[model samples]
Target: MSDHTINLNKAHFTISAPDIRKLPNDDGIEVAFAGRSNAGKSSALNTLTRQKSLARTSKTPGRTQLINVFEVEEGMRLVDLPGYGFAKVPLEMKKKWQKALGEYLEKRESLQGLVVLMDIRHPLKDLDHQLIEWAVESELPVLALLTKADKLSQGKASAQVLDVKKKLKPLGGDIKVYGFSSLKRTGFDQATQVISQWFSQNIENTEESDEVAE
Candidate 1:
């Protein structure tokens, strides 16, 4: 297990939501992780947050059934969303994941940013593009990530990043993209910087909310 507390002031398992509508509304900032199954979303999350089994990664696709939330601090939470486009899954199940993912992305008010993970070789598939479209349509900030970068050589990793960026251009330049690897611990600092940027924005929003409450 990764001990995130060493660098992160606070991190803890929170709760799970069947849908965004069901998410607790105490008004905390939320950062969400979403991707296709086997894209290493969970692994990257666990690695970044230093939580070994936080999101539950497995070879089995569509394992996550709910929006798993983690309280990273008193005022912020991390949401692990169900993976989309698991062709091996049953129709009913595929529908469920789609619903869960859609509802969360569209309705989760506290959701401040999204971390979209993709395998290095397959950075932006159809599912990935749909998720990006959802974020853009919903006016959500997204940090697009290519996972499993270690599987590629350094030269290949750079190429993958370029490929991803090229695909993202149609989506707009407002979104940020990067490559990550849990095994090699590559892109940790870059990923951290992205999260920290969101944290600052979240803090600003929280402060404003607090002042209004006063």
Candidate 2:
């Protein structure tokens, strides 16, 4: 079986943090999922975990309003961040969420990496760039998933993936990207591999730190 198969399926909902202060104790390694409104963020999480309802898929945008946490193991988590660019949400509430997300991205020490989703057709919009900029500033590793790849032909999907990689190359960080399709389950293994590698690297780093402290 694949490495992520067991751990991802073992994932379970932990808590929802409406604000940064409400987040769980900053002790475990976390990888967050971020995207614009209706960009298939929730679907990607569900697909990764192999749980149909784990992340709560919805037809409406901006339904995910909090930082939803899922425990994959004793000290590992998957965070579902609020989707940005929801015009229907109130300005004040949007700002509130933005503040929380920004703080979490900028200050959360346990956050090991981020998985950003974007529609294959609309690869990187303005808000997506803004988020990428934040990740660049944070010096955080990232895996960009182009969602809804089933909407396009194989050649087109491949082209889109290359296009994204070309665009993100200059950002200057450890970033791996792939085309993902929740419907066809394409790129599932690649996505899982990225997750496994990132989590394992984090564990290795922690072990090295502990050894040095001894």
Best by TM-score: 2
lDDT of 2 by residue, 166-206 (tens): 99888878888899999999889999888877788878788
**For model 2, what is the error of residue 89's alpha carbon versus the real structure, in angstroms, after optimal superposition?**
1.6
Query: Considering summed lDDT, which 10 consecutive residues are worst modelled in model 1?
Result: 1-10
Residue 183 Cα positional deviation in candidate 2, in Å, after optimal superposition = 0.6
Model 1 clash count equals: 0
Q: TM-score, each model?
A: 0.89, 0.94
lDDT of 1 by residue, 86-137 (tens): 7788899788878888877776678888899888888788889888877887
Tell me the lDDT of model 2 at 107: 84
User: Where is the poorest 10-residue window by lDDT in model 2?
Assistant: 1-10
Model 2 TM-score is 0.94
Error of 1 at 84 (Å): 1.0
